[model samples]
Target: MIDVTMTRAYEMMVILYALSIVLYFIDYFYKQAKIRRTAFWIVSIVWVMQTVFFLLYIMEMKRFPVLTLIEGVYFYAWLLITISIILHCIARVDLPVFFINILGFIFVTIHLFAPDQVQNPLGESAVSEMLIIHISFAILSYATFTLTFVFSVLYLILYKILKKKKFSKLWSRLPSLQQISMWINSSILIGNPLFFISILLGLEWAFMTLEGLSVIDAKIIGSFIIFVIYLIILVLHRKGKLSGLNYSWANIYTFLLVVINFFLGSKLSNFHLWY
Candidate 1:
């Protein structure tokens, strides 16, 4: 019964954390004070729950829960949440807080899913949990990139419409070209790092767990290719070699590669079972 209760509480905490992230995302883009306040309250609740869990673990273990990898991840996540709340209240640095929470959320998810200890030499369960973390990070990055693609498409449409002097209600409804471009840049800024981290974690897990795994596996190669392309795209944009319609088109094309790699690479991978 205690185990069941703890599991349920963790689930509730995760739900609230996810909701807070959504609220933060909205507040980030819309700059709505009420939404930001609500997100702050929700994050506060999550922090309290995390504190309760942290204390409980300490009491149960009779020590600080930071000696092992799993314990360290939980502690790191709690630290992130604590700092994010403090920053939200005092520093008023919005972007850093949001990104900190994102990192916290990833670690929290990993802690929730990972086994407390590896019981055997193989550690199959622990390896599987790491795979889940890898997939979670990858999907989150993909979602961010999808948002970037959408904004880029909108920017293109707006650019064409304005260039042709076709004024309509749509022009009023959409954000200005500069704002859309900023959103595109912000999404890429966040998404690229996330994808890179996912790739690193996935590679580490594979090396540790999978015997005789080849580096030329379809998914591995495809993911690396995609990462390199995005890095190049970001560098080009920074160097002013890619901008305006060309930048938007570059994003669109790269997203197509992401989609293809996601589907085709998964299908071709020998051990990439999750779909």
Candidate 2:
């Protein structure tokens, strides 16, 4: 009965953790104070539950719970949650808190489904959940880059129309070139880090979960190439060497590469059979 209760509590904690992550993501995008407060409360509850479990483990084993791989993972997750709460409350930084909680969620999931922790029938499902998260991050980054591309295209169009002195209702409705350029930069700033994080998570998952997965897989290579290109573009823009038309065109071309990599590279990869 004790074991069953513990398992159910663990499951509930995981669910709340996931829900808090989703809420944080929404708060990040929407900037809703209510959502942020709710997420904070939920995360606080998760932290309390984690603390309870940590104490229980220490009492049961008569030692700190950091000696083994599973215990260390749980402790690491707890630390992440603790730091995230500090950042959320004191620092009030949205992005760092969100990303830290993402890492915390990953570690928490790792602890929950680790074979040594318990005989969990959902072990395979946990692996699938990780895969889904990896893919979701990649897709979110890609979508952000696509937004950058659209803004770049609009910039070009507006630039051309102004250059040709074509004054119309569309000219009044379209955002200025500077505004579009700012959007382009903002999108890349957000998307690039997300892409980098996704790549790290993908490689970690592939190495730990999949057998005989190659680092040279087409999808992996393509992802790295895309990441590098964006990094370079960002650097160039920061140095003021790439801007205006060149910057816009660079984003457009990079997005085309992203499209190809996402489809063709996936098809070519041996282990990336799942779309």
Candidate 3:
């Protein structure tokens, strides 16, 4: 029963993916200067198609699929795809189309193969629109930090390549080190205050949604740990200790917490494990 609508959406996504891959391949193997441009326009169209299906699912289900494990993974796939395409359009990095294509394929596989089911929320209190807004902003901020982590990994790889004095193929695919560094910094600059607001709103939501003012769930504690870690980083960054390996490692730690929350700790984690 789930497959009926889900499969239809999947088919649309696969079609878009197929087009994107073909366009990327054309842009790569052919080396036609205009091919990448065309590929981008095509990817944009595909994004519109996905938007339709993504919204359709949400509307039909009457809840955000992105709140669950399977749906969250799927959303990550969509996010990465969108990020890669948008960055390509704006930055024009020499990143190998190969890796990008491979990533696309991998996400597609997960989207197609992963389970699909309506994951219900835990408590039934009608959260305020502001609370949902807080969650959205928090999730977007989370996504930015996640992207920053990816960029840090890219920087490290590029650093290694430069140290060995070999321009590995990946170097071509990535933005310049200076540019990537700035991206990481600016992203955090934006994420920090948004994160702070998110935490404040989260506290209010907890009080409003739950029965008491002091109910500390395991999830609450887990989230607090992350919140504190990030808060420390932001403060230190203000004092200027956020650079080099220290920066990368901090991102790495945050990324791990993100994975836990997005996967194992999300509402649908257990269901995904058993589905």
Query: Per-residue lDDT of 155-219 in model 3, one digit per residue for the tens?
Result: 78777888899985534656777887777777677776676677677677656665545535444
lDDT values, one for every candidate: 0.79, 0.79, 0.65
Q: How many angstroms is residue 46 displaced in model 2 relative to the true structure, after the best TM-score fit?
A: 33
**Residue 36 Cα positional deviation in candidate 2, in Å, after optimal superposition:** 30
Instruction: Write down the lDDT that model 2 would get.
Output: 0.79
Pairs that clash in candidate 3: 94-172, 94-173, 95-172, 95-173
lDDT of candidate 1 over 1-275, digit per residue (tens):
99889989998999899999999888877778899999899999999999999899878865455435576567768767886797678657565567678878998999889876522223335446566567567766876776677678878888999999995743454567887788789889988998999898888888887788888889889888888988888899889998899999999999999989877997898766533
Off by over 4 Å in 2: 1-128
For model 3, where is the 10-residue window of minimal lDDT? 266-275
Task: Enumerate clash totals for all models, in the order shown.
Answer: 0, 0, 4
* Structure candidate 2, residue pairs in collision: none
